[model samples]
Target: MQALTYLEEYHSFKEAALNSRFLKHKTIQQLIKKLPEAFEQRCIGQSHEGRDINLIQWGNGSIKVFLWSQMHGDEATGTMALFDLFNFLQLPQFQEISSLLAKSCTLYLLPMVNPDGAERFVRRNAQQIDINRDFNHQVSPEARLLKNTRAEINPHFGFNLHDQSTLWSVKKTGKPATLSYLAPAFDEALSVNEVRQNAMLVIAQMYKYLNPLLPQQIGLFDDEYEARAFGDNFQAAGTSTILIEAGGMFGDEEKQEIRKYFFLSILSGLYAISTRNYVEEPLQHYFSIPKNNKEIFHILIKNLLHQDIRVSIGLSYEEEPAEQGYATVKTYTIKDIGDLDHLGAYHIYKEETLQIEGPIDIYQPANFTLKKDNMILLSFKNGILQSKL
Candidate 1:
């Protein structure tokens, strides 16, 4: 209920400092230093590159809830939402929900778990290890620190936040999976114990509240068991782990809009736990949520002449960090060619008489110009979008 209210007034608490997805360790540190006295902030450990991994603690209730984000430096959406939640918790305007959370739950937030990877805007740490997959081995210091922190807290609930590929779409709706949730499976058989089931119930509650706003854009992430992933292990260790992934939106490239929904999701989940209302949610609702599928593309071109045959083309971009991680360079490539008529795309061009001025090669960089009536409509040079005239 409060979440819906917060949705209308999210701008008041949104973290303006983290307006972009290219968040660095220093930027977050400066923001952390400015947190109100209500939040207890400390340096929990150092990253592989000597960046301080900080933990901000709030509330003092019996329910221990641990939320961590940016395990993959590139997935900064969750960290931004966490900061927004921090602002929400500090504001007196929403003191009713704040009071409820403070009285019913204790929140431990670890933002930017992989600062080194974030520094380069890459998915892996400086040692080239995926921290999430290093759980069983503990080879990376960051992974070790995360594991030790979880063991120390032994939290009742865990929120594993990350971003997913923009190409993932909701089944049947053809809408981008802007946000996805999953109750990670602990075992190989994907069995549901009380711990895992509680997570599903919380996700169901979150879905019930979020679906109205997001519609078919919200989807359930795959539940395959990952033995080396933190969420699965945390669930096996008795913490009901809920995974929230921020995916793509049509025009919200920086995820500024998606971050709001992500923030509300966490708030809604917290509301469910604080009020103990998730138990009333039926298990069927969780299963009923749409599963993610790769039925979307960054750009789709249809009814274009290619070798005298009409075809549809799907283009996807590969992003590389640039300018010391301050920005990214996207190189669009022809991921699929032929019949992509059923798939959805962020940008689509479907003209009955469109001509291609260059070669169309599957799995190759996009290097062509699309024209209609001898007028250039779209142009790409070596995978870089040139112009839309």
Candidate 2:
């Protein structure tokens, strides 16, 4: 079947993921109401805010696949992909695949695991518990609901869905917008077990399908077994769980393009599990992509000398919540007197600087005091200059 296209035409991870016109609670309710009788919606539990935690179950296949998303409320990219998959399954063109899969295995989906967090665009629930890290305690309503739901379904294959920061790359060597996965380890020591190996086999096959499209942008996440993590708990329970972390599609202004890739990856994973098309060898190219790092700033001015002391200046961008129309810009403390390694190369002029004649509108650098006669201006892309009076 042709891959599902992203709903948005433009591609920005935050934009696409944050667009809730169709994925909101009301919209989801409407869609669920419209679903055919074959699909069943059950209230698994209540969230921290008393919102119903709903689960939609379809199909009667032997090999059950459980998929959940939005555990981190702000991480909505995977939730978008989940809805897209739902819509795809409902399409006429996908009927054959859907029907076939339905007859062979049950598909359970919890698209919005943290409704309260989603509303606030935060990572934690209303009580501030990270559901992902609450598995052991299961104190949070969302975590308890998930645990109960898992016990009820006892799915053979579990898909723990999430989105990662732009800093993440598949291999430490490739471009951004990479996809990553982890076959949940079965033991607390994170020992490689048969279930994990089987999950890896499917991941290897899925990599074959995604490599051509994503190239070096696909990677494996570290298989650390955290007692509170949902993936680890599920794996420890003997369910083969796959953690899909969508990450780093640079310049994907709307995240629409990345969403499509994520859709394709999901399809590939489903196919791998259903068909048992496990590849024996791991994808070595997975390690070719660069690891994600936060060392680089959004903007940087380099090669500046103050009082004969050479230093590098960096600026990082911060965005306000969606409610805030404009993003507040600020400068933060960064590494100084360092080489260009792991940093942007920007040159600054030794003589030119910013002049302050009156009260400043914004905070000035602590080290560089503003002078009325000295003018600060940026130099040819590489340097910052302080104009001498």
CA-lDDT, candidates in order: 0.93, 0.64
Candidate 1 lDDT, 98-176, residue by residue in tens: 8999999999999989999999999999999999999999999999999999999999999999999998899988789
Write down the TM-score for model 1.
0.98
Give per-residue lDDT, candidate 2, residue 263: 68
Candidate whose TM-score is highest: 1
Q: What is the TM-score of each candidate against the true structure?
A: 0.98, 0.76
Model 2: per-residue Cα lDDT over 11-109, one tens digit each: 322222235412455455566667677788887787888877789998888999899988987666777777677666767756776777777778899
Model 1 ranges off by over 4 Å: none
